[model samples]
Target: MLSSSGRGPSLVRSAILLAIAALVATFFTAPAAQAADGQISGLAGKCVDVAGASNANGTPVQLYDCNGSGAQRWSNPGDGTLRALGKCLDVSGNSTADGALVHLWDCTGAANQRWLVSGANDIVNPQANKCLDVQNRSSANGARLQIWTCTGQSNQKWNAPASGGGGNPQPGGFVVSEAQFNQMFPGRNSFYSYSGLTAALSAYPAFANTGSDTVKRQEAAAFLANVSHETGGLVHVVEQNTANYPHYCDTSQSYGCPAGQAAYYGRGPIQLSWNFNYKAAGDALGINLLNNPWLVQNDAAVAWKTGLWYWNTQNGPGTMTPHNAMVNQAGFGQTIRSINGSLECDGRNPAQVQSRINNYQRFTQILGTTPGGNLYC
Candidate 1:
């Protein structure tokens, strides 16, 4: 999965790459054949499409049997992002690694989202310093795209959209799309859903939907990155280590751990745990979570709302809410402090702190915002 991104390997690789002749023998499958406007015909003469023609962000940009549908109609807009159906063709996770998936996502001006037309129309992601490659050189329909070491092979060649002009700005209202959510947490439990998250947004209108457009996008990325780290990309629906489950109960609270000593174990995007946390969050959201902490695990809306509750209100170990930390330009580091500063910040746990930072940077790139400074707590 190593990339040719660095200067040394890139220079050498470039000098060695030779453009191979285009495919022939099968007229219908030859990408060299004339392509109609607004379509990027490639290997097998298949048009690059948003898988299932879905406008959902993070949809795969794949070589499918060309049918001239709207999914195949692309616009270069000259912005470096290849857009179709209102989303950019992006390298998954903003990844530069070889074999990294190329998918449709919110059009962020991030390095990985930009593409360059190389010799013979090879679309390249300068961030990865690799060519857009059809995985395995298969000419079959539904073949996916990837970033690979540029070999100048036909698989790396694309009848890409013309690079120039401006495409539509990302659709407003919500920064993170359902497909982008899936991309961020490909293995996330089904318990967390985009609809569930959006459903909970009205609960905290200013959390991600506030300020300037950049601020809005940045805040959304910051919140998701923090939660992604806390939940391991939403893969864990609840605390994994059962040994620590019972420790979340605090009998000292007046509520007395109504769901049981272990029922309050970590759950939801931010690992909302503890009897007190459940009780407080429930009261704030007007739901009875103390007796049914499991609702955070069983109901998607409840699960996401709990995470939003913490992000919008609870400061935990720090002085400000995670929401305030982001919108106030206090830097992503502050959110870390607010969430788990006692355990993970200020070199208390460098690796874990870094995991949160890495997610922040990657997600900000995906959301089309810069990760402002003071990333370390």
Candidate 2:
């Protein structure tokens, strides 16, 4: 058996091989599946607020053409619940009472709020044991939906429209609608507000660049798909001590303490921390690092620039193509390893350093490259 030190690299290699095999299998099967099953478009422009007063439950639910407003924005957690404006389509706090008011509330991870998207376009609240129903059976504009016992009614039916076009509604159910979905989470544009999925990719212009509309859309889709998984759907950040505090201050001088300076902790996209990183990022983005190390987390654009700088300059994407990483896995691994080591120059075992290898693996998977090979280190 390999020692623990040796095992880390070996296991990483194995993971890469497994990932490559999976990629090959997916490539062979995805096209056919895409053709046969049809595309799973977004639900942006087509999503409508159920008509009626936007208060709580018993509101008449009606479909209106989307206006790209927050009210029309919906979040499908893929856990069955569809959220709008930060509130969930809840079954009245999971009261389980029949004819319970379906009010929107903060997500509490309750069963009543837990939903399932059925094959028939029905948004089923299993805890309430009902389908989302339109109030008083009204089909007029400005109707809202209420939770009623599932009777398979037509009002409960929804149609998820295709992206950038008129979508045919599926028979017997509601579709989340693609146009409305994209509008709500409008690609890199959404990144401007938060450090989530849209923001992370947007932070890296080279990654987000699309030579043309077609290429842009494809690249955006792929980037979103992969980053969503890696970052846990933009809900999670890589920053350390995030759960406990809003910011972490560096107190140790051992890592790479400049002679008289204090504190050097990780922050922002991929948690770019330390005095050295701040300097490097500053150089890349033409910002003054020593003066504004906090900019990584304080400014979205700067955070993104820092991440791109790391990807391009420190991570070898600048000197080598992604394809080269595949061909020369050892060289790729070594470059990442070097970054990992150097990242600790300020302090050993920085949280970012601990997660570096995992992050790299995620990067390779997103790039659709094999993870294994030799170490250029």
Count of residue pairs whose backbone atoms collide, per candidate: 3, 40
Show where candidate 2 strays beyond 4 Å.
1-233, 236-238, 242-263, 316-377
Which portions of model 1 miss their true places by more than 4 Å?
A: 1-172
Candidate 1, clashing residue pairs?
77-164, 77-165, 78-164
* Model 1 root-mean-square deviation: 19.9
Per-prediction TM-score:
0.54, 0.30
Please report the candidate that would top TM-score against the real structure.
1
lDDT of 2 by residue, 195-237 (tens): 3323333222223221222322323333233223223333333
Highest-scoring model, lDDT: 1
Q: Per-residue alpha-carbon lDDT of model 1 for 278-350, expressed as tens digits?
A: 7777776668899998898888878887777666655666666666677667788887876677666777888
Which residue window of length 10 is worst by lDDT in model 2?
18-27
Error of 1 at 219 (Å): 1.0
